[model samples]
Target: MRHRLYVPTAAAACLLLAIPASAAQPTPGAPGIGDSYYPTYGNGGYDVSHYDLRLKYQPEDDGLEGTATITATAKQDLSRFNLDFALDVDSVLVGGKKAGFAKTGDHELEITPSSALASGRSFTVVVRYRGTPSAVEASGFTGWLRTPDGGVAANEPESAWWWFPSNDHPLDKATYDVSVAVPDGTQAISNGTLQSSSSKLGWTRYNWRSSKPQATYLATLAVGRFDITTDTTADGLPVINAYSKDLGANDGAARASVERSIEVADWLGEVFGPYPFDALGGYVPNVPTGYALETQTRPFYSPRQFANGSNVSVVVHELAHQWYGDSVSLKDWRDIWVNEGFARYAQWLWSEKEGEGTAQELADYVYSQHPADDPFWTVKPGDPGPENQFHGAVYDRGAVALQALRNEVGDKDFFAILKQWPTQHRYGNASVADFRKFAEQVSGKRLTELFDTWLFTPSKPSALSARQAAVGTVKAPERPRSWKKIRATDSVHAHRH
Candidate 1:
């Protein structure tokens, strides 16, 4: 049945037509999301809420083919938009209608919907793609790691581009459901919980779900033969630890450290706040990348992190990031201090608990070792350029700054700032300035002078302030040998951030 509306009169029709219409007009979305350091890292004009990926892999050829269904809401009316991806696309569909698509630049896929997408309209983008991720490189490196049996998708700042299309930045966090089909006899591990696994006709499909919002850099998955372990925290959150069967001599140390995932996460909760995610675990993949990454609930560890022996300090560093780096992420790459500083400080705290050294002792010792004229003082952790984003000063000096703050505000306020910072910004992004304001608000003290001396100034402070020197001054006796585990230069390469 059809209903008809009557225009009562020509005057009335004219009056209705005279009313204003919506102001929005379709325009091409920005090609980049405006990061000063890495401008082209993410796209603008839309926010992804979730991703549902269906993928299949051939380990023998390192080939991957997949269809990605991205759910997002347009922030502005748009005729076209971009996604950060590096793959061979076969077809694209916007809201079930065929859409035009083209590959642009090195890692961007520009898409044109059949019609303009109105502001605030929820839409679905389905992209069909296939490629050998190991062969694809952007920004002069490949995030995909090909192993003897299978491959691992794990890297910092940018990894999803090689394995899955995404709004590839910490600023655009979204939940994910990744389903990968691989040949039988191999296990696929990913972030969050394993939803389902089924095998049929010599192929196994493993579906993993990340119920919490996760940054694109922190989302990871690996498919290979593993010695998998399962446990639960006191809070009953599931813990899944996996180590490649071929770890050789490092196997014992890897398990010894990663096995403490449950213990370490719980300790971090008491020091920071309640664990932010629903799951807890770590994996030691047999890759030579030397650095371990805090990848959401399941942190990834390179075998070399344990080459010397058991390294629970590195474990503490990565798990602390579950709060500092993973739960409350960086608003921009320049806020590297907010992540590395807090994580390194946690290592110092762990040292105190293990009878190694107090945070103040560790801070003073580090300060005493670096001379006033040393170039180390020239690198400001708060604004170290892109080239020095992961420089050792960002980690060591960053933590030193925290100890200075603790002394300035006293223990009560400093601990409160630590626990509250993550609670206030849980599952979101924050800048170092935002953190300073929060600290000042919580401690009721002006921190600009302190932050300036430690974070902003490109040179070391004239000397540790009286508050910073309360722990017997920088000329204290030799620190215990165990201090090695408390510093970022501990040979573990925790500076991989």
Candidate 2:
């Protein structure tokens, strides 16, 4: 379910009467993930097809150095090619041969090709580099945290190059075969299913394979002391992984909640589509920060939030991304509702199934509770404010838009859209306009009005009569005071603008 909003000419003027003095700029072009600059590799350089990584971690120095063998398909004749990587890389090699490459800023590697890569041909580049991970406040890329037991914790985002060389953008989707070698007694977990593990030369090598094409930002790896737990979904999907050093102390509780994640996955598949990945799991490292991330194959969970039912929602949120965020990703950041909104809607759907309420009840609750003064489509998915992007508007308002769409399209057509969406656009990016076109095509109805009202417009239209508000009845919740509070809050918020 998705909705759009439109403002009438005269009414739009009235609404903007109190707008802030500063004019909003037109949305910028899609910037590469984790960095604000445009990418050079995809413009006129090498097109990376695959990557093979051999990484060595140094916990004492809080750093990692890696040797990356990248195979790229050339699109044009070129004597030099540039690669997008984070600031920490040191060197580059062309076809196993040393090549001169210079570091530009902290996010790009410029390589001078020894020989021109002819168009319609493939070439390999091997890069060797080392660096200590640095925290990126811009998008929360890489950072280290101090543990309670006097140890350090680290996670990489679009900024994996703070420790390793990576393409680091969503558009450059590629298949990765990675092998991480860590110190004795420590474990390294990464995207995709684990292939095998062997100890040699006093280092443990964990090999992982991600056959599915993945955006660079979703690529991740975590290294620490962790306890492993395995399980199976009722539908027979391999659910055999959860990493947490502390799970040993609370094995019963952790296992129970972890097992419930499988049930949630099953429900999402039944409602939406297939699981969209080969495997799914989480790693709860013994870190103090209560932050969770939806990496490609597995999401990194924070143990602090897993205490009660709180972690369950996080699990559903990340799992939903396997379809919305991972499978059919957003082409640009400004269209973030494609990711966060769908994932958030899935969370609400899971809650409704777990006896939270029926779909209508949940939709009514969102309509009644969410602040209507804010424009849903005004939120540019890419450069949204920190709190507004992933959590508030992208998640809550975006889900509400979907619910609104469901109301307009009906169940049969709506679910059909959901199931076909990932399958139709696998490994590709989509925008709001693309979804709107698809919906109209499937339902055989002009939904221009519904989309305008629900998405582009800043406020909900006047309540419709029982017969006019689509199908189903919404039994208004019992709290009259709550309704009044919400209306008053919205009025005030709108007045302030």
Candidate 3:
């Protein structure tokens, strides 16, 4: 889990003075309004306004039964309503009445409303399902147990079978309140703050409130016997309530980074604005996978990597996502840079603060690694297959794009724009073009070519020297540059195409 970190001493002072006193206002009457630049079938043709989920786990059968009450707001009056859901659901109900729904695939569901839902109106639909879930290979959507000797294993992609009906795409977001009834002693965790929990009728009911909008894939539920530790940040926000069954083994190292996590949060708030969630925490599950997930308020970490410091970067990366991916979501998969790029950039910013390297040094290192022919926004402007959207092309290359912009606009203005972005578009969505216009407006520079070259085109811009010059003094170190060789790996299964 060892990784590189960079820190910049002088850049912080320079960045504070770079921005102008006055902020630029967005232009009025722009076409394709909202965060996304491209046209979208709003709510993906189905409006999931709210969800009430009740799930009961049966460890004896190694399965669960979920009953969901979905309330949708219709934009158009139609005779038929379609809902997407993972395979394994048994039945559905519309307005408290049974309705026919057929499973089209492992990742899709088709349902006809018991009655037509008029435009500008809302209706409720419920689904009852049961299945033995299978976890996707290496994906965090896994359910498993640990051996007595402390080895980890799982059944992943379980959302396909164990969970309630869902669109299962990042673009389709909705509000959910989940209540899971697990065996008496086991704990259950999900997105957002916990509302209430109690034992009733031989089971424990864990109710969670996710007031913020969230994509279905980011939704999670963990049920196991875990030791819980809770603390709050200096700012009074819940610091970390990390959980693990093997407390003595990994807790010490994981706890050691808690303050660092808060420090990073405080630093980011100074640069990017306030932390987005009401609470921020991480979970170290006893799992074999080496990857992590940014699941809204709570992120999941692999216990196997908990002892290694390299996993702390995963914390930085995922926390950055709270502002980038969670707050201002991407409308389509192709615009995933809106998620990964900003998160990756935040990691670099953290490095700069940690005295790992100057921001310029890190930027230079990233630029040196990118292929000359690859652009940050090369993914097609549509639903570019999932595989094409989440790789280093989006993460590393996208961070490089922001670094280039920082170089061009200077750090002060660059951070102002970055801080302003989430505040203005919080809980909404955004695309690359929308971001470009916003950046241009904030910096008072018409950067169409810069945008086109780094994002839309197929190559890195040749004006790197000029761009660096615009940002003020940045001395490129002559030391051997191996940090640039640390390319992001395409090994995470959840990110697979």
Candidate 4:
């Protein structure tokens, strides 16, 4: 519940401008954040604090006109900086003045400011672009999905460049004010709370604001004919659910699925501390992305998956991610189990709460389901390869690992570790190493062997049995057929290896 907020002072800004760069003069910022899996995704030497994105969509041409104004503070003296962008750029302006820009490398938009930026100096860069927006293809699905009337922006990992210019990495968290204009009959929705909506001439614009520091991957923009419903949670947080009207007879069912997200959101607050944001909601689109993403306050869901009676548990998974993945993000792709494992465990916990099964029983099922030489057991959930980032090992096996830790440390320490992990690094970046250290610190127990056996080792071990023995015996309840479907469909269960 505690937050480390940074507020700029007038004196600080004045002092920063008065200072000068080193004798060598300013230099260009690094083109990437040095991530092991994605070294060229995010730029370094500057910290983005806010993004003001204005977009207008023309249905006639399927073209999107956009202007992005990014506010950031220089971490070092910089003559130039890079923004991850992949669109037809009209112009680039630095600090309200025209600046020279060029496209270099894969997705970098390098811009040289008119004047050198001193360390700690606050500055803004505006980029104007227009093009027929296209989604970045990956793993057989596109990040920014196109719809019948308009499109939905759900870029995970490294696809934000397909629509907007940004840092485009999970480590660089920034607040957002996204305004989108569409035709009078359509709707525009994004993250956070709806600030206002207005009509001018023949276009209607909806403005949204996410004041919390959010990673760019969680940023989203949905424009189309949607059934927008406004409500509030029991805790007073705003609820904004948007369902695609393309469902026709199933539109009501889709809307109900999104409304059910509030129940999961409310329950997640009780389990995983506060909700961590000012709002909670869901965006249901007809485009079947085959997966559900925890996109900030409003997660996007495929109509086929969400309205099929298994909505609550999956909603719980994504809402739990609001605390795990959104608030405390991963430092590298290898640490993705920290995001996925926590969510998978949340699914187990919710199912146990509903009397479907106990967390231990479910963990036991997944652990025993695979054969001794199965490749699923060979793939380390914590250190899966890039192609297998979302492998079942990362989910089912990851949950088994957490349950094993719980068995070793007892429920009191395990739940405490859960709450403390996110609260300690709220709205910040963390890694598997960070989680290991923090787990040991909070539980007052050394977890080196546990992590080694579960995360680093390629072969399955007897740890699951040892932990089960330590926890005593339990009856395995009958799992619902829906869970079987979850394992059957690639949406929830797919082994990459």
Name the candidate that leads on TM-score: 1
Score each candidate by Cα lDDT.
0.88, 0.63, 0.63, 0.81
Which candidate comes out best when scored by lDDT?
Answer: 1
- Tens digits of per-residue lDDT for model 4, 1-497: 99998877999988877785465578899999888777888999899999999999876556789999999999999999999977779899988999999988657899998998888999999999977765333334445677777887775676577678998788889999999998898888899999999999989999999999999989988888887788898878899888888865556656655678788877777778877899889888777556777889998777766444445666777788999999999988778988999998898888777777778878777776776789988888878877778877888888888998898889898998888788899999999889999889888999999998888888877648574568753654355533653453337422121
Q: Write the per-residue lDDT of candidate 3 for residues 1-497, one digit (tens) a residue.
A: 99787665798869867876433221111111122322311223356767788988755555667888888765556455555444366788877777777754334456666666566667788888775554322123434443222212222212322366654445556888999888787777777877889997788899987888876656667766676666777777765455656555766766665436776677778888988777777666666555566677776666544554334455677677788878788766567778777877776776677666655666676566545665543553222344455546666666667887887898789999999999988878787778988999899999887766666665555645584557743554442232331232123223222
lDDT of 2 by residue, 227-263 (tens): 6766666655555555555544544554555556777
Error of 2 at 386 (Å): 8.1
Q: What is the lDDT of residue 149 in candidate 1?
A: 83
Q: What does candidate 1 score in Cα RMSD to the true structure?
A: 6.1
Candidate 3 structure, TM-score to reference:
0.79
| 35 Cα displacement, candidate 3 (Å) | 15
Judging by TM-score, tell me the better candidate of 1 and 3.
Answer: 1
